[model samples]
Target chain A: MTDVEPLAVTPALEAHALSLVREGSRVLDDVSFTVAPGEIYALLGGNGAGKSTTLLTFLGFLSPSGGSVQVNGREVGADVAAARGAIAYLPEAATLYGHLDAYENLAYFLDLAGRRVDRAALEAALDQVALPPEARGRRMQTYSKGMRQKTAIALALLRDTPILLLDEPTSGLDPVAIDEFHAMVKALAAAGRTVLMVTHDVYGACQVADRVGLLRGGRLVGSFEAGPQGRIDTETVHAAFAARGAS
Target chain B: MSLVFRIAREEWRLWSRSRVVVIAALTIAVLVGVTSLLTARGVADQAANRTARQAEAEAAFFAQPDRHPHRMVHYGHYAFRTPPPLAVFDPGVDAVTGQSIFLEGHRQNTAMFADARSGADLGGFAALTPASLYQLLVPLLLIVLGHGIVLRERESGTLAVHLAQGQSGLTLMLGKALALAGVGGLLLLPVAALALAAIAGGEAPLAAVLLVGGYALYLAVWALFVLAVSLWLDRRSVALGMLVFAWLVTSLVVPRIAIDAASAAVEAPGKIESDLAMLSRQRAIGDGHNAADPAFEALRKQVLDQYGKQDVAQLPINWRGVVADYSEKKLTALMNEIAEDRMTREAAQSRVVTAFGIVSPALALGAASRALAGTDLATHHRFLRESEVLRYDFVQALNNLHARALTYADDAARSSDPEAEARTRVSAKAWSLLASFRFVPDPASARAARAVQPLGLLVFWLAVLCCAVVVGARRLRP
Candidate 1:
């Protein structure tokens, strides 16, 4: 008998014709996308473009009014705990417990996600996010925005979840920190993690994402992908984003 | 459950670092401790003072000189009401209801030495006992400290992260409530110690236990109420405003209005009114004091017939003493009927107040606390009734001596002639034959039984608030 090739692997995340209505207003309309294992997909748009709303839908925070969202080939609404268990979310301007130091915040959140990581693993994750070693033991209230973001990102990294959903992940980061974050995201993808990030920064999304979907007025208006150079064209996506703004 | 506990620990850690929370907790602990000590001292002092006065009155009664029995009837004894041991915690209604009543031959006297002269308006929380702090200020402290437990999470976006970490809404709600309840339990510690001390001091053990339990449940109810309000509201400021308004209405406004409404709804006749009614009834029975009244004339004829003598002088018993004894029995019977009617009206008024407890947990908790401590209106009425019974018994015994100890001729002439008056006097040792007045307090079991209805009302409040929490939990979201 001829050897049979393995069937195509199921996508780690899928949003098919996802439509959401919130407070009597349509926030998402007919959005469809797929994030395979080891892929980073970014939904790029301006404010009110439903980018964050899409990420929330996949995390089971918001139920779509029409169609559906799935995590690892299973409907999100069918098993919310399992859906959440598989994903680590970093929200826009992520704020951790101000009363707790960076290390404590990391441990607390990691414990909450049902992970029993040791201090060494936590430090390693913090080191990966390039958080200042001196600031790890001080209360986060005294921490700068970039420091807090780094702590939150380190927490997401320590969760070791198969899927990561991030919204405006680098909103307050310095340029160097933003570049480092991009490299970290790339490394996590190489380790076979599926990431679905939503942002308004076109150049940043192009720098890190394997595929970029441009959104406007709650709809996916255009799409782009990396060329043979192994990076998406920033200028082309920027032109599309600006054109949509003008229209 | 472990997850809930973990979340609770985190919440404790967060609040423990908050200076405002720590200060508020310390303030409540100090207040409870001080209030408990001072009130315990006050209750002990009052109880000792009443017991001493009662003994002094008894000694004076026994030290009387030989005299006519009727004169002894007018010189009545005083019965003092010693407060129950549990009153240290509650002292409820005691300041308003007075502690001593005078017992005499032909009248029912109201209790005396009340702090407030009139009306049943709860005395405006004038008594600052440990129970009052538990009922009033602790709940306010709880609201001040915990109204932001859930709303703060939402406002800071930590709620979204928590949910994303796979924490269920129910778990979060319950966990935060457990943390708040722990704070409430901390406030109750000093009060519990005092209650335990009362029990150890040979007080009503059941009542002391119930008092502690009632206050604990009350605090728990407040915790649930604070949590439900926090979960239902979307903003911290709004939750705080709503919760404070709720506390003011339930703890302060509603209870006072309920008491005033009860007093107004069921109007108990005043002492003057009851006394006048009794006087009119006495008149209908003919003046027992007037030996020649038609009512006693029949009694005189009956005595002659019983002795088979045409004249009272031939009878073995002194005729004038017979008249005094006969009239007194009739008067005592008439007074008792009138007194019973007045007591019934007062009891009805109390029932109205108890029914109003369903509307306010503060009223419910107060009723439970008072009933358990034996300082309620029911307990005071029991004291009055018992004293009246003793009054009737002792007065009748003196009248019996008047019939048997004196000669008819001497009793008749004693008022006009000095020699006959001297002869009519009985031995001073006769006073020793009479029993001393001792107020038998309601049994611990009975006092505990009276608290059941109010305790049930408190439970009902808890149940209703629990339902609200469940609904709020279901609707909780990031």
Candidate 2:
């Protein structure tokens, strides 16, 4: 038999090397990135490295000073709402209303997004994120950082969009929870969804990400791909990030 | 729109799940309910008390020992202001205006027994009526409940997530507004129901509906303002602080300042000036005693000419009737002119104060509610005018009775001779013929006139807020 044709992965999102300016200051300088279908792209950066700004630009939270961002092949600024519907964002710290339980928070978000999932479907989505069924009924005020993060993941899951943008998703979780979160991200990518994560957790990123990029002073300085036989070590990626800083 | 309702429902569920929101809502409902009940009972009791006193005063007037008609005119009658049924809801400025005036023959009396101010030395807190609660306290609670609608989401970074989930800023703002407006509707329900019940029971005017509508629109404006501020501000704390300041300025500070300015701009003639002017004018016109007084002498010549027998007797018509009619006409003219001037000044003041309703809708609503209740300055002026007319009627009726029942010679001699005084007294049955004072309010006509201005102002603000919501929605997007 003829060799099977390799599946061509299409980009779920693309940004045409954009710059975002705010109040006469360029926060994002010629940043370019893309997430292909079924790929995990880890955007690594330190404080003020413009990683958050770049994600916001892609999410249509800010207008680019120049160039453009696209989701599902549509320009972000031109049709922001339509573009945004194709992606889900879990911001840093992901504060849910303390007065609402996990299920209630999820329902509010779903309803706001014009989605009407039944209770069973909502519960199944929470179960997908490994959130305890019992904890879903408790107020978010009683939740730990890991539990809140899981609820955020549940919210992102319920949207069922093709792309996900998570900002420092593992920043405040314990080591075990961080590992579990990386597993969840890997599972999402394995299911043919594009996932972009902004983080300084190089080891965690190396564990889950197929490709890693270093962001420094509003520009990406290095890019690397993990080999299928063995994962790239965290120290090598960290050294590259540090070198970009030194430069 | 359906998505907005779904979000609103979810918000309501979340709000109900919060103990603080529930407690705050309960507190407002209870306060308004209790205040309304107390006001209704107070108004009913006051009306009963005034009715009893009016009966007693009428009885005492007719119970007097045998006396000349002129003596009865000087004795005068007391008219008590009847409170309107819906005054229980707002009682707007009712306590500031007097409730009773002593109407007499030759002069008009200023109303008495009104307390100019209510509440404590701080002066900001007025009486805790339904109107005050709706105007000041309910809006404060609304601001507290609504000021964090968007800001909280933004602060927690959920706003970006929400935006990413296909929620437009307009939809989000509408949802929050609906949620808070639901609470507002709840707060208004009991009072509105009470007002409706009062109307059904025929104790209140139909204009109570206009009052309720005014209040609803006012509260809605507050809710919209709070939500707009929430969408514009970046932090919950900033939104909350700004809304509280706006409430204070619009509801509390601006009304007091406007009233004071209006009062200063149109100075009302004081009671002493009016009383002195009436007394001096009466004395100058002779009290029909001084033959040298030109007005009285001219009146006497007319009476004599009409009689044609001139020595004050031998004519069929009583000279006493002619003199009484002339004196009554002169006094009525003077009082009417002064009353008209005072009313014009008060109207000017009211116009000035109402013009500021644009700055504070609370004032507009308050003024409109008071007018609908028949407890406003217009009502007070009505009472004074009606009382003056009734006084004129009563005194002139007694004068005509004197001309017919008693001889002119007996009337002229009765003051000096005790026996003639006994003969000069008319039968007490005549007093029963006198008309009792009744305040007939055309509520529909009055409400139609008063509602237009306040409703216009409310609509203007609504338009402004619609524009604000549009701007806020644009700003709220990620």
Candidate 3:
């Protein structure tokens, strides 16, 4: 039998020289990248490196001063609602209503996104994120940072959109919780979900991401991709990241 | 459900859970109920008292013994200003202006026995009426509860999430505003019930309905105002400060400023000045009591010529009664001229004050409320004018009796001879012939019409805010 090749697929997310000017300062300058369908791409940068700003542009929260960003082949600015409909966004240290329980917050956001989930399904998503069963019903204000992060992650998962944009996804989590979160993200990608996460942790990015893009001064400085071995080298990516930061 | 409904439901949920919001809403509701009951009772008592006193005064006047017609003219009747059925909701100028006027011949008495003169101190607070609660306190409560409806979403960073969830800023703002309008609707329940009661109690249905509708619109103005301010300002605290400041200016400060401004601009004569002016004008017509006064010499000559007699005693009718009848016509005309001038100036002052409603919506709402309640200055002026008409008609009827009923010989000699005095008096049965005064209120349609301009101004305010909301919603972003 003759083997057939796969058709070329559109990128799930794209930024063509995306530049953002806010209140007279360039936040993202000539930044460019693309995440293929179902690929897990991580953007690594230090503080004020415009990583979160990049995520916001994908969510259509900020308009680019130059160039453009697209989600699912539609320009974000042209069809913001359409773009937002295709993606689930988890902001850095996402805050759900402090007065509501985890289940209530999940229900509210899912409803906002025009999705309905049964109680069992809600519990399954929470369980997948390793949130404690006892804590799911308590107000988020009573939650610790890790618990809150898990609930927010569960909310994003329940959104069930094809594209995911996570900002500082594993922030304030324990080492064990971080590893669990990374595994969950990989599982989602394996299920053909597009994942774009921005973070400062090089090793964490190298561990779960199919490719790592290094960003500095609001520009994409370098990129690392996993070879046939299916994993990128952490040492190489770290050295390159550190070198860019020092420069 | 739709996006707006979802957002509104969420907002409603949050507010329901908040202790401060729940407590404040409950407190205002309670105040509404309490104030309505108290004001209703007060209005009923006042109406009953005036009605009873009016009947008693009329009965006593007709119970007098046989007397001269001029004596019956001096023993004039009392006209009590009956409270409109809706006065319980908005007392308007009733407290400041007199509720009763004493009517007599050859004299134009001012209205007397104002409620304010009876001295019930409200501790410097606005009189606690259902209208005041709806106009002033409800809006303040809405501000306290909802100033942070949109601000909280932004501050908590949920606004970005909401947008990313495919909800536009417009929907988000509209949803929150919808929730606030729902609260305002809840606050309107007591006022609606009060208005309905007024209508059921035989008040003008159109006016009562208009009163309720005006309040709903007024509260909506406040709701839109709160939402617009919340959406426009960035910081929650600053938004709150701005909202409270706006409340102070529109609700309290602007109303007083408008009054002061109107008073200054129109320069209405005070009661003392008007009375003295009326008295001074009256003196020029001569003492109506003295038949031989020089001012009436021409009048005396005219009457004698008309009768074809050289002397008053030779005439068929009593000359003194003729002089009294003729002088009264001149005097009433003079009094009316001055009173009309004063009313014209007062109406102008009212127009100036109401015109300021364009700047402050509270003034607009207030003028509309009072106009609909039939408690405004225009209605009071109607009472004054109608009462004067009754006075003139009744006094002339008695003057007619004076001319034809008694002989000239008896009238001229009555001061010296007791037998002549007895003969000068006609039967007390003549007093029964005079028509009794009953104050006729303006038609319900007219009262409703008076409210149209101010109501239109309220609608203008609401339209401007709605436009602002549209602009605000369009400009909204996280």
Candidate 4:
């Protein structure tokens, strides 16, 4: 009798043995990672450790030199539009058009992602992101960083893409805003969207991530699985960071 | 809502917020309005003056007293060029070129009385016509509206979010281009209204429609160029500076270079030199007024032989008048040769300038505008050629009267005998028989056909810029 391996389910996103080079400098060395659906994966790394490079590689801007990145079982480079349809991104400093109102910002971004939403839906998404009702029609220039981050999250909410790739999602937020962002991110993971966030703050990563990975020199050198409390132990993540720093 | 329209709306919102852009566009509109009004008034006044002078010339021609037909031939006629209807908007070449020409027997005259001689600040380039407004100011305003179109997103880090959200680089580029095109369309509306009003008011050619359309495409080309540079450049200030440099090169530097190239490629001699050459060539032929010039000896023999007479007195017709007619024919032919050569040289120069449209679309658009308005060098050449035709017909008709209406004895004896000179005078009714001058501009199809090349160049520029935008989009990176 022939033995065959049992197939479980395709990951929401999978980057297997990915390698990337920029301007003759190797930026990402053989990196393998996967984020299952409904899970929030946090990547902790220092500057120049290829944290953003991995995200960009998944975004199809930087082609992987060694392996592949797949979202919803479709390869990143094979059909970028198809793979892109399933992901929403919020950068470190999430930027909304300063000249556009929050409503317009949401509408424009949602439309770009092929999700047509009316004003009511847009306002609903803003509310979902805990944005104030009064800020919906005012230009984004008047909004604070937290409000801008809310607007960006609201775009992700409006786009309804299944995969969310966020870079420094909770950076530059006040303590209260940081707690609120953590709660909102937890709520997003509970609602069945896969979240992959890259950040320097280990506590923020431990607070919301179902699983955590430490990226150093573009490789996933260490990982921590979430406890029943839905948090990776900060002490273990810190030890990993310290060990990598010492070496 | 269509995606492109939404993009355009976003652009409009952004522009509305930019106080500088709003003020600049409004100022351009107001200036265009003022320029249109001034151009209309100026065109009307010039047209009226030309009409009046033409009437005076015609009245003076027929008011001649009884005189020898040959004497009336030397009286000559004057032709005045009429401004076309579209000239009220474009006023192309009218201020610099002469508007009146003199046509006399034996010698062709240069057009004289240009408006520049009055020195009313033509050199300032503040004439404020619709043509100058589009050619000079509208593109600047477009740059103000569009230079930050893409760079702003890049600088603010929104472009990465956009690209990561499945918005292809091509889509953003297209959206920004649509936005800039919308602004350009908005700016073009007022000038288009002015042109449309002129066309509807009567006496305007269908070619004026081409003028309006040409300006639209011209502005679109500007939009495309602005968007392409914005896509490629990394900073707003750098994009703006580069776009302004491009505008200066296309609108000012390239045109000047094209003019220099044209001047070098073709020799349009100075007025004095041209006149001297014509005089020299005319002298090489016999003087038309000298009845006994050796050049007319063969003509005299032909006339005498045709009449079957051995002596001048035995001929039925006047030998002196016949020699005068023969000399006029020889001189007219020589004048035609000289005039054709000058026009050919001038046309070659214009062609050289027009060919430079490959480098700068402003040259193409300016040439198209002037051609559509009937105020180009070609139009002026046509006027001259037609006026010369009229001159030849009238002069030859009077010369025919000289050969037919009087006797040879009377014509020759009139120089020595007073009664014979009195008898040699033909009736004034003969002067009335001379035809009036009329300038016929080329047909619409003909002029529009010639305009096809420049128009194609504009399209070519647009296509190339579009391709550049696409190429820029493919490698769109912050």
TM-scores of the candidates, chain A only = 0.96, 0.92, 0.96, 0.93
- Among all windows of ten consecutive residues in candidate 2 chain B, which has the lowest summed lDDT? B114-123
Q: Candidate 1 — what's its lDDT?
A: 0.83
lDDT of each: 0.83, 0.77, 0.83, 0.81
Q: In candidate 4, residue A9 scores what lDDT?
A: 78
lDDT of 2 by residue, B167-187 (tens): 778887888888888888888
Q: Which ten residues in a row have the lowest lDDT in candidate 1 chain A?
A: A238-247
**lDDT score for residue B4 of model 2:** 79
- With a 3 Å backbone cut-off (N, CA, C), the pairs that clash in candidate 4 are none
Model 3 TM: 0.95
Segments of candidate 4 deviating more than 4 angstroms: A1-7, A118-120, A227-230, B112-127, B201-206, B412-418
Candidate 4: chain B TM-score equals 0.93
Q: Which of the predicted structures, 3 or 4, would earn the higher lDDT when compared with the native?
A: 3
In order, what DockQ does each candidate have? 0.74, 0.70, 0.73, 0.66
- Error in Å for residue A152 of model 1: 1.3
TM-score, candidate 4, is 0.93
Error of 2 at A156 (Å): 1.3
Off by over 4 Å in 3: A1-6, A227-229, B112-125
- Model 4: lDDT of residue B116: 30
